[model samples]
Target: MSGETPLPATDPRSSPTRRISIVHVRSGVHILPREMLGTSTFGVAMKLLKWLPTQVVDRFLLIMAKMMIGDTEKYGLKRPKVGPLELKNTTGKTPVLDVGALSLIRDERIKIVSEVESLTSDGARFVDGGEMAFHAVVFATGYKSNVPLWLKDAGGVLTAEGKPEEHPFPNGEKGIYFVGFSGKGLLGASVDAIKTALDVSARWTRLSETKDVVGL
Candidate 1:
Protein backbone atom coordinates (compact mmCIF):
# COMPACT_ATOMS: atom_id res chain seq x y z
CA MET A 1 0.00 0.00 0.00
CA SER A 2 2.88 2.38 0.61
CA GLY A 3 4.81 1.91 -2.60
CA GLU A 4 2.38 1.42 -5.47
CA THR A 5 -1.23 1.85 -6.52
CA PRO A 6 -3.50 -0.93 -5.34
CA LEU A 7 -4.64 -3.34 -8.02
CA PRO A 8 -8.31 -3.54 -8.92
CA ALA A 9 -9.74 -6.76 -7.50
CA THR A 10 -12.05 -7.37 -10.46
CA ASP A 11 -9.20 -7.45 -12.97
CA PRO A 12 -7.40 -10.80 -13.08
CA ARG A 13 -4.83 -9.39 -15.51
CA SER A 14 -3.49 -7.10 -12.79
CA SER A 15 -2.75 -9.98 -10.40
CA PRO A 16 0.49 -10.95 -12.16
CA THR A 17 1.67 -7.33 -12.27
CA ARG A 18 1.41 -6.76 -8.54
CA ARG A 19 4.55 -6.79 -6.35
CA ILE A 20 4.93 -7.45 -2.66
CA SER A 21 7.52 -6.12 -0.19
CA ILE A 22 8.30 -8.15 2.91
CA VAL A 23 9.11 -6.57 6.27
CA HIS A 24 10.41 -8.92 8.96
CA VAL A 25 9.54 -8.20 12.60
CA ARG A 26 10.96 -9.90 15.67
CA SER A 27 9.87 -9.54 19.31
CA GLY A 28 13.15 -10.64 20.92
CA VAL A 29 16.51 -8.93 21.43
CA HIS A 30 18.65 -12.03 22.03
CA ILE A 31 19.89 -12.93 18.58
CA LEU A 32 21.54 -16.21 17.64
CA PRO A 33 25.12 -16.14 16.41
CA ARG A 34 25.74 -15.59 12.69
CA GLU A 35 27.53 -18.97 12.57
CA MET A 36 24.51 -20.82 13.92
CA LEU A 37 22.12 -19.05 11.58
CA GLY A 38 24.28 -19.29 8.46
CA THR A 39 25.59 -22.85 8.92
CA SER A 40 24.59 -25.73 6.59
CA THR A 41 23.86 -27.99 9.55
CA PHE A 42 20.09 -27.95 9.22
CA GLY A 43 20.15 -28.38 5.45
CA VAL A 44 22.44 -31.37 5.64
CA ALA A 45 20.34 -32.94 8.36
CA MET A 46 17.17 -32.60 6.27
CA LYS A 47 18.79 -34.15 3.22
CA LEU A 48 20.10 -37.07 5.26
CA LEU A 49 16.73 -37.61 6.90
CA LYS A 50 14.82 -37.65 3.60
CA TRP A 51 15.47 -41.30 2.65
CA LEU A 52 15.69 -42.74 6.16
CA PRO A 53 12.87 -44.49 7.99
CA THR A 54 10.62 -42.24 10.05
CA GLN A 55 11.80 -43.61 13.40
CA VAL A 56 15.44 -43.34 12.36
CA VAL A 57 14.87 -39.83 11.03
CA ASP A 58 13.28 -38.78 14.29
CA ARG A 59 16.20 -40.08 16.34
CA PHE A 60 18.67 -38.48 13.97
CA LEU A 61 16.94 -35.13 14.21
CA LEU A 62 16.89 -35.25 18.01
CA ILE A 63 20.62 -35.90 18.00
CA MET A 64 21.18 -33.10 15.53
CA ALA A 65 19.15 -30.68 17.69
CA LYS A 66 21.25 -31.52 20.73
CA MET A 67 24.41 -31.00 18.74
CA MET A 68 23.24 -27.71 17.22
CA ILE A 69 21.45 -25.99 20.12
CA GLY A 70 23.60 -27.68 22.82
CA ASP A 71 22.20 -27.37 26.34
CA THR A 72 18.79 -25.72 25.89
CA GLU A 73 18.15 -25.56 29.65
CA LYS A 74 21.25 -23.42 30.11
CA TYR A 75 19.96 -21.00 27.50
CA GLY A 76 16.47 -20.94 29.03
CA LEU A 77 15.04 -22.60 25.95
CA LYS A 78 12.83 -25.63 26.26
CA ARG A 79 13.37 -28.23 23.59
CA PRO A 80 10.26 -29.98 22.40
CA LYS A 81 9.99 -33.66 23.23
CA VAL A 82 9.33 -34.62 19.63
CA GLY A 83 11.88 -34.41 16.85
CA PRO A 84 11.86 -31.57 14.35
CA LEU A 85 10.92 -33.70 11.32
CA GLU A 86 8.12 -35.42 13.20
CA LEU A 87 6.75 -32.14 14.50
CA LYS A 88 6.80 -30.58 11.04
CA ASN A 89 5.01 -33.56 9.49
CA THR A 90 2.33 -33.62 12.18
CA THR A 91 1.77 -29.85 12.17
CA GLY A 92 1.96 -29.35 8.39
CA LYS A 93 4.47 -26.57 8.89
CA THR A 94 7.02 -25.71 6.25
CA PRO A 95 10.42 -27.36 6.69
CA VAL A 96 13.43 -25.15 7.25
CA LEU A 97 15.66 -25.74 4.24
CA ASP A 98 18.26 -23.13 5.07
CA VAL A 99 19.63 -21.08 7.96
CA GLY A 100 21.52 -18.13 6.54
CA ALA A 101 20.72 -15.19 8.77
CA LEU A 102 21.52 -13.94 12.27
CA SER A 103 18.81 -14.60 14.84
CA LEU A 104 17.40 -11.84 17.08
CA ILE A 105 18.82 -13.54 20.20
CA ARG A 106 22.35 -12.43 19.29
CA ASP A 107 21.58 -9.13 17.57
CA GLU A 108 22.49 -6.20 19.84
CA ARG A 109 20.38 -3.67 17.94
CA ILE A 110 17.10 -5.34 18.85
CA LYS A 111 15.33 -4.38 22.10
CA ILE A 112 13.17 -7.29 23.15
CA VAL A 113 9.81 -6.71 24.79
CA SER A 114 7.37 -9.01 26.54
CA GLU A 115 4.61 -8.17 24.12
CA VAL A 116 3.18 -5.25 22.21
CA GLU A 117 0.31 -3.92 24.34
CA SER A 118 -1.27 -1.50 21.91
CA LEU A 119 -0.73 1.01 19.13
CA THR A 120 -0.53 4.50 20.50
CA SER A 121 -1.24 7.66 18.51
CA ASP A 122 2.52 8.00 18.07
CA GLY A 123 3.69 4.37 17.65
CA ALA A 124 3.80 0.93 19.32
CA ARG A 125 3.61 0.67 23.10
CA PHE A 126 5.10 -2.34 24.86
CA VAL A 127 3.53 -4.05 27.83
CA ASP A 128 6.66 -3.15 29.88
CA GLY A 129 6.07 0.60 29.41
CA GLY A 130 8.41 0.95 26.46
CA GLU A 131 7.48 2.82 23.28
CA MET A 132 9.06 3.28 19.84
CA ALA A 133 8.26 5.67 17.00
CA PHE A 134 8.35 4.62 13.37
CA HIS A 135 6.88 5.69 10.06
CA ALA A 136 5.66 2.16 9.21
CA VAL A 137 5.34 -1.15 10.99
CA VAL A 138 4.76 -4.53 9.37
CA PHE A 139 3.83 -7.78 11.11
CA ALA A 140 5.59 -10.94 9.90
CA THR A 141 3.19 -13.29 11.58
CA GLY A 142 2.15 -16.57 9.97
CA TYR A 143 -0.65 -16.81 7.41
CA LYS A 144 -4.25 -17.92 7.44
CA SER A 145 -6.15 -18.73 4.23
CA ASN A 146 -9.12 -16.43 4.69
CA VAL A 147 -11.21 -16.07 1.55
CA PRO A 148 -11.83 -12.48 0.62
CA LEU A 149 -15.27 -11.22 1.74
CA TRP A 150 -16.07 -10.25 -1.83
CA LEU A 151 -15.76 -13.88 -2.96
CA LYS A 152 -18.43 -15.19 -0.59
CA ASP A 153 -20.82 -16.07 -3.38
CA ALA A 154 -18.26 -17.98 -5.47
CA GLY A 155 -19.40 -21.36 -4.11
CA GLY A 156 -17.44 -23.96 -2.13
CA VAL A 157 -13.99 -23.41 -3.47
CA LEU A 158 -12.56 -23.19 0.04
CA THR A 159 -13.32 -25.45 3.00
CA ALA A 160 -14.83 -24.30 6.30
CA GLU A 161 -11.31 -23.80 7.64
CA GLY A 162 -10.51 -21.67 4.54
CA LYS A 163 -8.02 -24.06 2.95
CA PRO A 164 -8.46 -24.82 -0.73
CA GLU A 165 -10.72 -27.85 -1.16
CA GLU A 166 -8.60 -29.10 -4.06
CA HIS A 167 -4.84 -29.48 -4.20
CA PRO A 168 -2.92 -27.37 -6.75
CA PHE A 169 -6.23 -25.72 -7.65
CA PRO A 170 -9.54 -24.89 -6.06
CA ASN A 171 -13.05 -25.87 -7.12
CA GLY A 172 -15.94 -23.75 -8.50
CA GLU A 173 -13.77 -21.64 -10.84
CA LYS A 174 -12.63 -22.38 -14.36
CA GLY A 175 -9.50 -20.28 -14.61
CA ILE A 176 -8.62 -19.99 -10.92
CA TYR A 177 -5.51 -21.93 -9.94
CA PHE A 178 -3.13 -22.10 -7.01
CA VAL A 179 0.56 -22.85 -6.81
CA GLY A 180 2.73 -23.56 -3.79
CA PHE A 181 -0.19 -25.02 -1.83
CA SER A 182 1.55 -28.37 -1.58
CA GLY A 183 3.34 -27.32 1.61
CA LYS A 184 6.41 -29.12 0.24
CA GLY A 185 8.72 -26.10 0.70
CA LEU A 186 10.36 -23.85 -1.91
CA LEU A 187 11.85 -26.36 -4.32
CA GLY A 188 8.66 -28.39 -4.29
CA ALA A 189 6.70 -25.20 -4.91
CA SER A 190 8.80 -24.39 -7.95
CA VAL A 191 8.14 -27.85 -9.38
CA ASP A 192 4.46 -27.47 -8.60
CA ALA A 193 4.41 -24.18 -10.49
CA ILE A 194 5.95 -25.84 -13.54
CA LYS A 195 3.31 -28.59 -13.52
CA THR A 196 0.53 -26.06 -13.05
CA ALA A 197 1.81 -24.04 -15.98
CA LEU A 198 1.77 -27.09 -18.20
CA ASP A 199 -1.72 -28.03 -17.12
CA VAL A 200 -3.03 -24.51 -17.76
CA SER A 201 -1.43 -24.40 -21.20
CA ALA A 202 -3.09 -27.69 -22.14
CA ARG A 203 -6.46 -26.46 -20.91
CA TRP A 204 -6.10 -23.29 -22.96
CA THR A 205 -5.24 -25.29 -26.03
CA ARG A 206 -8.32 -27.45 -25.56
CA LEU A 207 -10.52 -24.40 -25.18
CA SER A 208 -9.12 -22.85 -28.37
CA GLU A 209 -9.63 -26.10 -30.26
CA THR A 210 -13.25 -26.28 -29.13
CA LYS A 211 -13.85 -22.79 -30.49
CA ASP A 212 -12.29 -23.75 -33.84
CA VAL A 213 -14.37 -26.95 -34.07
CA VAL A 214 -17.56 -25.01 -33.38
CA GLY A 215 -16.71 -22.56 -36.18
CA LEU A 216 -15.93 -25.40 -38.63
Candidate 2:
Protein backbone atom coordinates (compact mmCIF):
# COMPACT_ATOMS: atom_id res chain seq x y z
CA MET A 1 0.00 0.00 0.00
CA SER A 2 1.16 3.51 -0.75
CA GLY A 3 2.52 5.20 2.35
CA GLU A 4 0.92 8.55 1.37
CA THR A 5 -2.48 6.99 0.84
CA PRO A 6 -5.14 8.19 3.29
CA LEU A 7 -5.85 4.64 4.46
CA PRO A 8 -4.47 3.88 7.91
CA ALA A 9 -1.01 2.32 7.63
CA THR A 10 -1.15 -1.31 8.73
CA ASP A 11 -0.72 -4.70 7.14
CA PRO A 12 -4.07 -6.45 7.22
CA ARG A 13 -2.21 -9.74 7.89
CA SER A 14 -0.63 -8.85 11.24
CA SER A 15 0.84 -5.49 12.19
CA PRO A 16 1.74 -6.73 15.70
CA THR A 17 -0.61 -3.92 16.72
CA ARG A 18 -4.30 -4.03 15.73
CA ARG A 19 -3.53 -2.49 12.33
CA ILE A 20 -5.93 -4.65 10.35
CA SER A 21 -8.47 -5.13 13.10
CA ILE A 22 -9.05 -1.46 13.97
CA VAL A 23 -8.42 1.84 12.31
CA HIS A 24 -9.99 5.24 11.82
CA VAL A 25 -11.16 5.52 8.19
CA ARG A 26 -13.49 7.88 6.43
CA SER A 27 -17.15 6.81 6.68
CA GLY A 28 -17.68 6.64 2.91
CA VAL A 29 -14.71 4.66 1.60
CA HIS A 30 -14.42 4.45 -2.18
CA ILE A 31 -11.51 4.71 -4.55
CA LEU A 32 -11.40 8.25 -5.91
CA PRO A 33 -9.06 10.29 -8.05
CA ARG A 34 -6.28 11.91 -6.08
CA GLU A 35 -7.79 15.21 -7.18
CA MET A 36 -11.45 14.37 -6.56
CA LEU A 37 -11.84 16.80 -3.65
CA GLY A 38 -9.83 19.90 -4.50
CA THR A 39 -10.77 22.81 -2.24
CA SER A 40 -13.87 23.13 -4.38
CA THR A 41 -16.38 20.80 -2.76
CA PHE A 42 -17.16 20.23 0.91
CA GLY A 43 -16.57 16.47 0.86
CA VAL A 44 -13.29 16.66 -0.95
CA ALA A 45 -12.22 20.01 0.44
CA MET A 46 -12.29 18.95 4.08
CA LYS A 47 -10.27 15.92 3.09
CA LEU A 48 -7.66 18.12 1.47
CA LEU A 49 -7.08 20.21 4.56
CA LYS A 50 -6.17 18.59 7.86
CA TRP A 51 -6.77 21.61 10.09
CA LEU A 52 -10.55 21.97 9.65
CA PRO A 53 -13.24 20.48 11.90
CA THR A 54 -14.92 17.64 9.94
CA GLN A 55 -18.21 17.94 11.87
CA VAL A 56 -18.72 21.46 10.58
CA VAL A 57 -18.08 20.29 7.03
CA ASP A 58 -19.09 16.63 6.81
CA ARG A 59 -22.85 17.26 6.57
CA PHE A 60 -22.59 19.71 3.71
CA LEU A 61 -20.09 17.51 1.94
CA LEU A 62 -22.35 14.51 2.41
CA ILE A 63 -25.28 16.40 0.93
CA MET A 64 -23.20 17.50 -2.00
CA ALA A 65 -21.96 13.97 -2.64
CA LYS A 66 -25.51 12.70 -2.43
CA MET A 67 -26.17 14.69 -5.57
CA MET A 68 -23.66 12.50 -7.33
CA ILE A 69 -24.39 9.33 -5.44
CA GLY A 70 -24.05 6.67 -8.13
CA ASP A 71 -21.80 8.67 -10.38
CA THR A 72 -19.01 6.22 -9.62
CA GLU A 73 -18.36 5.68 -13.28
CA LYS A 74 -17.25 9.29 -13.57
CA TYR A 75 -14.98 9.03 -10.53
CA GLY A 76 -13.62 5.61 -11.40
CA LEU A 77 -9.94 5.28 -10.62
CA LYS A 78 -8.32 3.21 -13.32
CA ARG A 79 -7.19 -0.16 -12.07
CA PRO A 80 -3.52 0.16 -11.23
CA LYS A 81 -0.90 -2.29 -12.42
CA VAL A 82 -2.25 -4.37 -9.54
CA GLY A 83 -5.43 -4.89 -11.54
CA PRO A 84 -8.92 -4.35 -10.06
CA LEU A 85 -9.01 -3.61 -6.34
CA GLU A 86 -12.26 -5.59 -6.08
CA LEU A 87 -13.02 -3.52 -3.04
CA LYS A 88 -16.30 -4.30 -1.33
CA ASN A 89 -15.41 -1.56 1.09
CA THR A 90 -18.97 -0.29 1.33
CA THR A 91 -19.49 -3.44 3.36
CA GLY A 92 -16.59 -2.56 5.65
CA LYS A 93 -16.00 -0.04 8.41
CA THR A 94 -14.78 3.49 8.32
CA PRO A 95 -11.91 4.84 10.41
CA VAL A 96 -14.09 6.72 12.86
CA LEU A 97 -16.41 3.82 13.82
CA ASP A 98 -14.08 0.79 13.99
CA VAL A 99 -16.29 -1.52 16.07
CA GLY A 100 -18.26 -4.52 14.92
CA ALA A 101 -22.02 -4.27 14.42
CA LEU A 102 -22.90 -6.33 17.56
CA SER A 103 -19.76 -5.61 19.58
CA LEU A 104 -17.92 -8.37 17.78
CA ILE A 105 -14.41 -6.87 17.52
CA ARG A 106 -12.92 -3.77 19.11
CA ASP A 107 -9.55 -2.72 17.81
CA GLU A 108 -8.39 0.93 17.86
CA ARG A 109 -5.47 0.56 15.51
CA ILE A 110 -6.78 0.20 11.93
CA LYS A 111 -9.44 -1.81 10.12
CA ILE A 112 -8.27 -4.78 8.05
CA VAL A 113 -9.27 -8.30 7.20
CA SER A 114 -7.24 -11.23 8.56
CA GLU A 115 -6.48 -12.72 5.16
CA VAL A 116 -7.83 -12.91 1.67
CA GLU A 117 -8.05 -16.66 2.12
CA SER A 118 -11.02 -16.17 4.46
CA LEU A 119 -13.03 -14.08 1.94
CA THR A 120 -14.42 -17.01 0.10
CA SER A 121 -16.65 -20.04 0.24
CA ASP A 122 -14.55 -21.92 -2.35
CA GLY A 123 -11.88 -23.09 0.06
CA ALA A 124 -8.27 -22.02 -0.70
CA ARG A 125 -8.57 -20.03 -3.92
CA PHE A 126 -5.64 -17.69 -4.35
CA VAL A 127 -6.02 -17.17 -8.12
CA ASP A 128 -3.77 -14.13 -8.14
CA GLY A 129 -0.83 -16.02 -6.67
CA GLY A 130 -0.99 -13.47 -3.83
CA GLU A 131 -2.26 -13.76 -0.32
CA MET A 132 -4.75 -11.04 0.66
CA ALA A 133 -5.86 -10.64 4.23
CA PHE A 134 -7.67 -8.26 6.52
CA HIS A 135 -7.97 -7.81 10.27
CA ALA A 136 -11.38 -6.12 10.29
CA VAL A 137 -14.15 -6.35 7.74
CA VAL A 138 -16.54 -3.54 8.49
CA PHE A 139 -19.86 -4.85 7.30
CA ALA A 140 -21.40 -1.55 6.33
CA THR A 141 -24.91 -2.76 5.85
CA GLY A 142 -27.88 -0.42 6.16
CA TYR A 143 -30.33 -0.19 9.05
CA LYS A 144 -33.70 -1.85 9.18
CA SER A 145 -36.24 0.89 10.04
CA ASN A 146 -39.20 -0.69 11.72
CA VAL A 147 -41.38 1.36 13.99
CA PRO A 148 -41.97 -1.36 16.57
CA LEU A 149 -44.75 0.43 18.47
CA TRP A 150 -46.03 3.23 16.24
CA LEU A 151 -49.77 3.60 16.71
CA LYS A 152 -52.32 5.91 15.20
CA ASP A 153 -55.37 7.42 16.88
CA ALA A 154 -57.56 7.10 13.79
CA GLY A 155 -58.90 3.70 14.73
CA GLY A 156 -55.71 1.94 13.59
CA VAL A 157 -52.73 4.10 12.80
CA LEU A 158 -49.42 2.71 11.58
CA THR A 159 -46.27 3.88 13.30
CA ALA A 160 -42.62 2.99 13.48
CA GLU A 161 -43.65 -0.46 14.64
CA GLY A 162 -46.44 -0.88 12.06
CA LYS A 163 -48.90 -1.12 14.95
CA PRO A 164 -51.40 1.33 16.42
CA GLU A 165 -50.34 1.24 20.08
CA GLU A 166 -46.86 2.58 19.76
CA HIS A 167 -46.83 6.36 19.48
CA PRO A 168 -43.53 7.30 17.86
CA PHE A 169 -44.76 10.50 16.34
CA PRO A 170 -43.74 13.47 18.41
CA ASN A 171 -47.29 14.82 18.30
CA GLY A 172 -48.95 11.49 18.89
CA GLU A 173 -50.70 11.21 15.50
CA LYS A 174 -51.48 14.92 15.32
CA GLY A 175 -48.20 16.81 15.37
CA ILE A 176 -46.03 13.79 14.59
CA TYR A 177 -43.96 13.69 11.42
CA PHE A 178 -41.58 11.08 10.02
CA VAL A 179 -39.58 12.59 7.21
CA GLY A 180 -37.57 9.70 5.79
CA PHE A 181 -37.41 6.05 4.69
CA SER A 182 -40.65 6.08 2.73
CA GLY A 183 -38.86 4.54 -0.23
CA LYS A 184 -35.50 3.06 -1.19
CA GLY A 185 -34.35 6.42 -2.47
CA LEU A 186 -31.83 8.84 -1.02
CA LEU A 187 -34.20 11.63 0.10
CA GLY A 188 -34.79 10.32 3.61
CA ALA A 189 -35.50 13.74 5.10
CA SER A 190 -37.86 14.57 2.27
CA VAL A 191 -39.76 11.29 2.59
CA ASP A 192 -40.20 11.70 6.34
CA ALA A 193 -41.41 15.27 5.86
CA ILE A 194 -44.01 14.31 3.28
CA LYS A 195 -45.33 11.35 5.29
CA THR A 196 -45.48 13.32 8.52
CA ALA A 197 -47.45 16.08 6.82
CA LEU A 198 -49.89 13.61 5.27
CA ASP A 199 -50.38 11.91 8.60
CA VAL A 200 -51.07 15.20 10.39
CA SER A 201 -53.48 16.44 7.75
CA ALA A 202 -55.41 13.17 7.60
CA ARG A 203 -55.72 13.03 11.38
CA TRP A 204 -56.90 16.64 11.55
CA THR A 205 -59.41 16.11 8.77
CA ARG A 206 -60.81 13.18 10.68
CA LEU A 207 -61.06 15.22 13.88
CA SER A 208 -62.77 18.11 12.12
CA GLU A 209 -65.67 15.84 11.08
CA THR A 210 -65.99 14.24 14.53
CA LYS A 211 -65.95 10.81 12.85
CA ASP A 212 -63.59 8.00 13.78
CA VAL A 213 -61.62 6.69 10.83
CA VAL A 214 -59.70 3.42 10.49
CA GLY A 215 -56.16 4.11 9.33
CA LEU A 216 -54.07 1.10 8.46
Question: Which candidate should be chosen as best, given lDDT against the real structure?
Answer: 1
lDDT of 2 by residue, 157-204 (tens): 554445334445434544434454333233334555666777778777
Model 1 C-alpha lDDT versus the unseen true structure = 0.47
Model 2 ranges off by over 4 Å: 1-117, 120-129, 143-179, 183-186, 211-216
Runs in model 1 with CA error above 4 Å? Answer: 1-42, 94-141, 150-152, 166-173, 184-188, 205-216
Query: lDDT, candidate 2, residue 120?
Result: 39
TM-score of 2: 0.31
lDDT of 2: 0.36
What local distance difference test score does each model get? 0.47, 0.36
